[model samples]
Target chain A: MELAKMEALIVDDHPGMRTAMRLTLSNLGVTHSQFAQSANEAIRRIKGQHYDIIVCDYNLGPEQDGQQLLELLRHNNLIDLSMIFIMVTAERAYEKVVSAAELGPDDYLIKPFTAEVFRVRLERVLQKKSAMAPLFPVLQAGDAAKASELCNVLAASHPAYMIDFLRIKAELLMGMGQAEAAQQVFEGIVSERAVPWAKLGLARTLRLQQKDVEAESILEGVISESPEYLAAFDTLASVKDKLGKAGEAQEVLSKAVAISPNTLARQRMMGDVAMRNGDITAAEAAYTTIVEKGRTSFFRDPNDYVNLSRALLECGKNEDAINRLREGRQSFSNAPEAVFAASVMESQAYSQMGKAAAAKEALGRAMALKDSVPMTDELKLDLATACYRSGDEAMGARLMDQVVRNRHEDARLLQRVRKIYTDLGRELEGEQLVQSSTQAVVNLNNQGVLLAKQGNLAGAVELLTEAAAQLPNNQQIVLNAAHAVLTLVNREGWNQDLMLKAKRYLEEVRGSNATHPKLVQLQTLFNDVQNKYGSRV
Target chain B: MSGQDEALLPAMLAASLHEVKNMLGELTLSLDALQQQCPQQAAQIEEMRFVTRQVSDRMVQVLLLYKNDAGVLRPNIEAIPPADLLEEMLMEARSLAGDRLVVSLEGEQAPPYAYFDRYLCEMALMNAIHNALRFAHSRIVIGVGRLGNALCFSVEDDGPGYVPAVLQRAIEPGGHSRDGGTGLGLYFADRVARLHCNNAGECGRVQLDNAGVLGGARFQLILP
Candidate 1:
């Protein structure tokens, strides 16, 4: 495409900088250009029109920075990946460099540059974009294999982009689930030069292959060598979490948050890991930061307020915890889970403060909404604890029994459930209950499996489906039911009822235990069934 | 200063420098537009613009060195095609010189890409090019190619080479013999060069030599 004919958008909050960029863009022979003073305005323009090039300033003032804007644009699929996006900024510090590099813009230009410098950078980006223009359609169509093949051909033909092409090729390989090939490509790049991004790519490939130790070592080297590489920290945190070192994972996330606290996802991760490790203070701080920073992010969740109040209560700050719960209701009253979790937390707080009457009243309110509220296992645990402390032993035992039956194999969650009963002076009873509940679920799963093997797929699915409803917290039972339903569907040839049941089972455990061994296989099966039979239904 | 205070000083300086750089950018735009209308006085306007650029370049150098000294400048090493880097350097040199001098990129045409921090390398080359523009006799040339195992970027001019006394203390930043020179330009170049370490753990180095393509002083930044 001709340089002058392509449209451009210049985004900078400072008018002087915008005017300067306009002159620079005009000098490069770009006649059609637009300016936006903030990321919001830029997004509106971007959504309304398709500009060939966008020059965005890194600091877009308060609404959203360039990085967040780019993330939102990419995340929402509002902009095609092929557009030429150049990040311009005055800060050349490693902080900004790391943040911008993580986003992988076409080019980045530091400010205080001459018009000549601007033109040279923009032209280089345009050259790279135009060279890869043919592959954009395949990539946008989500044809990973086709995109990888086309990228290889284009890289061989256009040797000038061989290095960048290799990087893209590795990424495409990863997207296509060819982690071994991606690792090979990344290894080749790292052997040539220990580029941090390439090293990180290799680490991610190793991670995809479940080589957590190898990925963790490489990630450790990356962050130590380049302290400002925030993504490495995040990767290392997850790797540690996978390795079952929740404390280390929390530490890694804390380090990352120390460097860049505005990332709400990292803050949330930090809170989760800290809570899992039982570091109430750390979890409280992380959740507080999340609540504060989440105001500007689209990722804001009402759960943060609930988690923050729970953490405060755990830290024995009853007054502060009560205040947080009150604030959560005021802010997120529309979310039913938030309101229910708030009542549970309030009951627990009041019980801990020796206000028996108030605690009993709050627990009643929580129990009254039990049928209306969609319950997660964590919420069940909270309500059970509240009920036990508020002198509702029978109700607490029922809820705790449900938790034990559903997650019998989850030792940590089982331990937490046992603790609720033990704290209520029923340790022996809780142990017996846990043992019996676990045995019952195991027997049900075994029988279901036997039925499937004996060609009684329908009977197996029926048994497991009923078991899943009774033991809703049992992921193993749910997955077992899903598998039996798929087996039954395979035999019966597209049963809409079985497909819906299988989908419901899979949906229950979607984000929870996504790392389960059979989760991916089950999801793939469910998707295949939907694709093959969804239309007829 | 305490470590925390030392770390904050560079950020403050960079922030203030950002404001100054924006103003300079605006001034350059106005000067560039005015130079077009009044070609008769283009030389004087170009000279003023050169000074503005130099001031901005100095601020960048200072901020970079501060970050480097505080151990905060982690080089984002990457495989950079030399042709693109030199092309960019030549463009900036052309704008700074306007019609006063000729600027061109010379040497290797293909990509046996050099691994370095592209931004810092570009800034270092711009500094070298700016220095060459001040001393060159109507012509400046930038050379990019492999020198043995190192990737070398050199700016050469037709003007007289560096004096013997200045050459003696060439590598010592802030130790130059000249009173007028800030001595920061070469210092930044050397710092950036030294940051690029090879697999063998050998850092890069900078060199000063005369009688290059232009037969004047050649400021070479060689990275391993």
Candidate 2:
């Protein structure tokens, strides 16, 4: 952590600015420095080597700016809390840049700052990083419980960073699904001072506890007072969406996008909200922006292409939709899931254009490729739409039943299913399908839980394991199976086969939804069981 | 102006100012490089750098004022140690003053941390230091202390203080003194100060007086 021993990456497109930073770093005893002329180059260098300090210019040519680069680095786990990332901005209106960033840099230095100021800010961040260094490993290991406990210890030890530690503790609590505990922490901070971030955190905790009305009011005040706080706008939009005000949510997102249009996730969210509101024009615009911006970004996903194509088809632009899918096919040719999605959307577009023969061909291709990849709910719904449109009603119904059963708890997806069924004049049948599928899953889950409570761990394990096998994509069932197996192992002994089965189930659920609320608890339970009986197993 | 034009004008100005600030930033960096390469002429180079930064600061002031007029200027507040902030100001002030004037903190002690927007407060205080650098005959003292429940940061110089007209303008809130100077720095300081409000609903303010520890102009940005 000594300045002389630290490796530094100075990212600025302008050679003069880079040289300035290099000279500045050398003066500060940071001799081991590397330079990157653009965000892409910086990313490449960062991927190759570890740096103690990264000084990135805000405007790195035309591609990803410093804020976006920070986001990408954090999102991809290329950087951690230990590294110092300082954003250098020429714009004095840096609030816009700061607020737009979902993951902000450790600190920001305005352009033309003296070497003295730079050193101070760098040392300040380094002090903070060193202070919280102990918690980073625990957090990286996904031990939220230990991390939250460490936050309290660190808070008591590092008085200067008490607020920061509390903030992290609250966020960790929220992530671990302890909403009430997180709310208390946020309330403590809010009572002390109405910091915008703390207020936003409080609103989030409230929303987590289903107090959307209170959350919405706080968000409105935060947004009104700090309009540049883009996170507030995003939270408000979600709160509105949860309250069943899709149109209002779309409007809020539109305002947020207008303020800061470079965020890909926000644009994707706007597209989704607009789609839900049945505003095809707005959806198309948002998705188009995502497609264009996502081309060179690491945050790009295959869903961007599929969503764009879906938006185009919804707008009756069949040729455009086909062209988009073709483009997606070219870009993601090696990705089976992407190819499957493209083929499915292509079939829908062709069927809408009355190309029955071509539609059938695309549907056949999609069905063949579907088994090659794990089917997501979105892709399943799209494929089901294609099947229904191609006059394969039975296939469509089957896909719908699987989707409903797998994602029985997702109200939004259920709404989409209902909408699709209603559009096809099969509302009654759709209701029946949803009710039966939901009831079946509930009964299976309840039976396992009841059996386990009644000292029937063996029965619970067998029942839930079979249920998981039948609904391989069902996160709840897989997690339930993992929980049951872990509990059985914990109570009795570690049976090798059951332990392996539980591990596989946990892995499957994690692969689908890594941030599932129950994931950390189940993972901890699994680890505990392994530690307890690994020698015998 | 049409309503559309009225809305577009500030954005256009902001964009142009942004471009100019960027160019000035490049120029300042080049000046820093020149100063380091030619240490003998560091004073001249530092002067150029100071002017470049002053221009950049002025541009930012105008941009912030425009944002305020457009109702978008919200300060990002945080808990910053006052002593650390003043230490940074001292370093920058010493660099700008070079071998000409002795710039120092008022006391050897550190002040407690306070809640304010570091960037805005830095800009405002640096503006005060720059003015003091221009007018101070021998010394400039920057200090932080408490004014009632508010945190007060003062920049005092050993020279003649502000004139009557400027003092008059300071007392009158929202007074636009279109006279000798545009008074944009003081206006920006006022705006930034007012942006910070305490839990008691007391807004921050700027205080100007001839009573200085250095017997010169004393400018204090008092933030609640």
Candidate 3:
């Protein structure tokens, strides 16, 4: 409560709040403080003095909000490690809270406050800080285990701080895969009232448990109600995209970007969707944004460069696309897949730009460098285009066969594969290849039906699983496989590989149908699997 | 900067007021700290403190009106605890009201956090506390926690409550109550409340009504 010991900096656009706040602080025994009228001045004051506290307003100016400024300070590590940063805000905007929370400030105070209220709020923050102060060194050192122990000790003693403490404990439990404990904690919050974050957190835990339908539904509910909740939108989009609803996912993600343009991952996601849907313009827009904005982010994925550059090649911006990929390859210290992707992209660009000879030459080098990159079905689909363009009909046909085979039961992917082969004047081959894979897929479905009818559940599961492996994108193969296994699983209860195989196949099914028809039954089986085999994943 | 510059005069006025508001905030915090260091000189600093709060309160009021037009005022409602609401409101009230007022807790303690736009509610209470501090001759009292069917909060001043005309206008966002206020504070509050309100049923708001303790104004916000 002594003003002499406390050092503070006040940042606000309003001179009067600063004055009144200063006078009020004086009356309450806080005398020494610095003042800044705007964010620019605040940054200057922050640099000039090591203030014990910083009071910033949420709405700073036209260009930079308080949240953005705080991020800048944090990214730069301008504040001392122990600095008690607080934002003086009056706006109760959700975007502000999310952005504020995302930035991870120490504490924030709203405007037009009296001395008594200020003291109480400060006291609460300081008390929380004091409790954590002893363990701060370990936390600062990034020792989660030690910090968890200290926090756990504090939590057990202080039930008043249980909510805050358990929030951290739940995160640790989640991180440690202590699902049963974390579930009880989350369910406690849920039974009382729905905390969106806790709900989402639990939903994430369910996702880790491979309960895609439950996770997707929770995220969707949050998204529908809180349209501006960007994270929820992203999560829902991710679930949808993973579930093979690329179009729906694209629409939702596009809406999120419209609200608050996702700087990196969202852009990459959008680009991937655009490519899948064959909207080269959108792919270019999203990819270009990611390449420009996310190059320096810790969350930077080299796939953005690869995907965006590929889009550019598809749109016939060969030189620009190749250049972007080349620069990205040099800049990013990522996996070998990135380098391989660059080579693939470069080869595609060269061939598309009418330099077929150069294209093969680059492909030769890429193939030589890496024995073979297990190109994703997406990459293979694109690479087939370059191969066809380079006049390698046999090679192109072979690659197309694999792509079509891998995604046998996926109508959209099948259609896409057909279109690719069609564009290359290989309609007959594409149709024939898809027919073979599709027939095999149809056989597995029929076998499962007959076996289940005949009570040969084991045979039904085995045959369906083989069919699913042959058609990674097929839901029916996976759905029936899980169904057959679910039937067999109870009678033949939790055999490791069989349940694991069933689980893997179910994920593929869920990846194609986030809300699959047979998901509820499958979840019960998954729960059984977890109960039999502890939550170790 | 646009070609139809004359039509944008109001925007310029708003921007100017924003700048003035920033100056008021800087002065308020700086002087309060100075006043604390020089506690013996309370008589000399009270005028500065009063003007600081007045200017800040008015500037905040103006900004509240302008906020609806700004790009960042999107309200996302959540199930907020009454205690969280009180905590946010209390922080704002104390910071802007100065040492002249006493903001405390009252009523049965509800959940600490609520499902409301925490940021928006904070803004509304700030303006309410500023008004309380301006009117009360000696002391202003704020009691928060909960009251009735919903979590009720009140900011009471020993001074007289709102006059009828002003009270009516205060209900409307951007409403001008007596040539004195920009009337933006209450208007913004109403808009903010409506944002959280359900069109299917019920209202979510920060309202200025009778404190029930005295004939003083009580700003009650109930979120369902």
Best by lDDT: 2
- Model 1 alpha-carbon drift over 4 Å, by segment: A1-12, A15-54, A62-64, A71-80, A94-96, A99-101, A114-116, A172-178, A354-375, A387-409, A451-537, B1-39, B148-150, B160-170, B174-183
Give the alpha carbon lDDT tens digit for every residue of A166-205 in model 2. Answer: 8899988876556678889989887767888888999987
lDDT of 2 at A87: 91
Error of 3 at B53 (Å): 3.7
For residue B109, what is the lDDT in candidate 1? 43
| Tens digits of lDDT, candidate 3, B157-212 | 66677767775543664466534766766676667666664433566666665544
> Model 2: DockQ against the native?
0.41
Global Cα lDDT for candidate 3: 0.67
Cα lDDT for residue B60, candidate 2: 85
Q: What is the TM-score of each predicted model, taking all chains together?
A: 0.83, 0.87, 0.68
In the range A1-537, model 3's lDDT, one tens digit per residue, is 244688988777778778877886677676888788766777777777778777677777654567656766876668744677777676434245563233446666655455776777666667666655666686567554455677678866654455666667666555444555666677776654455666666676676566778888888876665555676777778777767788888898899888756346567778878788888999899988877766544345666787778788777788998889887887776357778778777888887777878899877666664455556777777767767777777777777776765667567778888887786788997889789867766776887889889988888877877766666666666677777876787676557667677666665665555445456456656656556655311
* Model 1: per-residue Cα lDDT at residue A391: 76
lDDT of every model, 2 decimals: 0.80, 0.84, 0.67
Best by DockQ: 2
Ranking of models by DockQ: 2, 1, 3
Worst 10 residues of 2 chain A by lDDT: A528-537
Tens-place lDDT digits, model 1, residues B43-110:
89978988987898887778778778878777777776788888777767786787789888787643
